[model samples]
Target: MGTNTRRALTVAAWIVVVAIGVMLSIQRFRDAVGSDIGTDLRTFVAAAEHIRNGRSPYTEFGYVYSPLVAWLLLPFPDFDAAVGPWTAASIAALWGAVAAVTATFWRALSWWQRPVLAGVGIVTALYSALLSLDLWLGQTDTFLPLVAALAVFFASRNRQIASGVSLAFGAIIKSWPVGLGLWMFRRGVQQRGRLIAATVGTGAAFLLLALVIHGPQMFSEWIDRTLVLSEQDLVAYSVWGAGRHLFTQSAALEPLFVAPIVGTIVSWTLAAFIVALIVITLRRPGDDALSMWNIATAVVLLIPVCHLWYFVLALPLLWTWVAHALKGTRRLESLIAVAVMAVWWVIVFRLPPLDNQFGESTPQYIAVVGSSLVALTLSVVLSARRDADRAVVVREAVPA
Candidate 1:
């Protein structure tokens, strides 16, 4: 087939995939809307309602999210009366933001590559199991991907101010997107004055909104609420969490404070990984912005406390990477990408949560070990490959 014909077919296929995925997501969301699920969404809504009633969302309610996220939730009603519509609306808005950012990034790609990139994005977004879990729990993980996508898109376009604002907004909502700010700084994008302006502007906007919604006292309460939540035992339920949990659960474990030890180890590991990635990207200035972002997002996703919804943050970058990688016929990496998507779907949909019941089984151990190994292995392999590629490019660019 001619290249154009192949591209057309690819585009048609992606459209179908995206349509089907949307239908499935809607069906799952409908089934889950009225069910009592996910604590984060409920907490956010409650806090919002408190503020709307002329009470401090921070002082009157126990909410852990940033004031801006709570403020955004304040407009929506609680789950009691309009659960279905409210849940659906939130999902729709989150997905719409994802779609918009994806489209903006797509426009930056070459015509022939856009379709392939869209296909990868659809695959990542639809990864039925992940979306199912997010919908079933009414989780806000979807926002992570949307926010990360916006940050990346703006940063790639040299809109540093907008990127900083997006990063700040995401951080306020979930606290993970602050990693993006670090990533930006490592990339030397932090030197742009607009980035500082954007960060300050976004912070001021959040403070202003908080004051308007809940009076000045909300600031102190917000800090207190966050501190209380942080001290709680919401330790790792993620892959990294699994290891920490196991170590803590062991009878022979030391009294060195398992959570903090694990946390510190993970923090240092992530810092080293980021430094290496930044150095590699710096050496290969010819590499695309999306590629660098993909590596950064992947590293962040592999962090111990990262939840399933965190995968959403990696989708945009993944789409960009897969599109370019596949264009050059990198079949093995493409297959790995497919496998990663499958793993996410399985975890999001099939893996049943162990509710601290006493019955231990070999199958449970197998499931946990197998999943962690897969995630960890993929993370290592991908990071190594990117580093190696950068090294090769640097070597070839030098005089013989």
Candidate 2:
């Protein structure tokens, strides 16, 4: 078959897979949207409503995100009835926007690659599966990925100024996306000017929006709320917390601090691996598309407090990696990434109760931490190979 025909088949197969995955998730999706999403949405609604009533939303209400994020939610009424449907629609719209933006970036690729890219997009769109949960709960995690993806996509395209702005805006809304700035800086001086412009413009825009929406006092309140949230112990809510809880209750593990410390070590190690990958990519030439996607995915995965939805950013790269891996020239590194995703899916779906009397045991920690290590190691090795290939290409193209 012609390459084009083969590519078409690949895309058709990807669409079928995505459709099935979504179909399987329908019941879970409904349950999530039907339940309370999270306190963040409630807080957002209350704050916006308070502002509409001439009360300072930031001061009287609790809000940790940037003013622009809250302002975006202001158009909807404060009542539960209004917030429910509005939040759902907003999330769905954001998901669609992110997918569209991703597609735009992939439009220039070869016909065969496009199908793989589409598969990546679909996987990215569903990476968190938690977004469906958030949708059910009427939450904003759905919009988070959209903002982050746009920021990275724009930045990679040399629209540094816009990219910076998007990054700043996303950061204001949720602090985690700021990590993209680290990736941006690591991208070097090739597009620094645009990056600076975008960062400053976006930051200024957000500040101005804050001033208009809640007056100057809003900034102080935002700072205060952020500090409070930052200090709150996450032990009971996160992977580490769940692991610790499980080990203590179920197994006879003695050192209580071991689980959290081990988890922290694993998380930071993964982060360092990602940073190294980015540094290597920066030193090489060619593979710009893959390099950009790799950096974005690594940054998202490396963040300490990553939730299930955070994985959405990794989906595009994961798809690309898998497509390349399955094409018969397997990279041990890519296979590891695939393994990590599989393990992650199992853990997320089977999460233990936060307050379950049984503590997280050594076995559970081993499973999670071991999987993370394998994934990170694979990422590093695969990234090295990718960089090596690019170097060879560049060298070969140089004049004798």
TM-scores of all candidate predictions against the true structure: 0.73, 0.73
lDDT (tens digit, per residue) of candidate 2 on 1-400:
9888887787787677567446534544455546655455677777777767787666544576665555666787754554556554544544454454545456455555555545544544544444554554454555555665666577557676666776665566676666556545543346777777777677777778668756888777777776666533332323343344333432323334445656566445545665676677555412433554555555655544444455445444444455455543445755666667566545543444122222244455345444544544455467567667756777999999
Clashing pairs in 1: none
How many clashes in candidate 1?
0
Q: Which ten residues in a row have the lowest lDDT in candidate 2?
A: 350-359
Say which candidate scores most in lDDT.
Answer: 1
lDDT of every model, 2 decimals: 0.56, 0.55
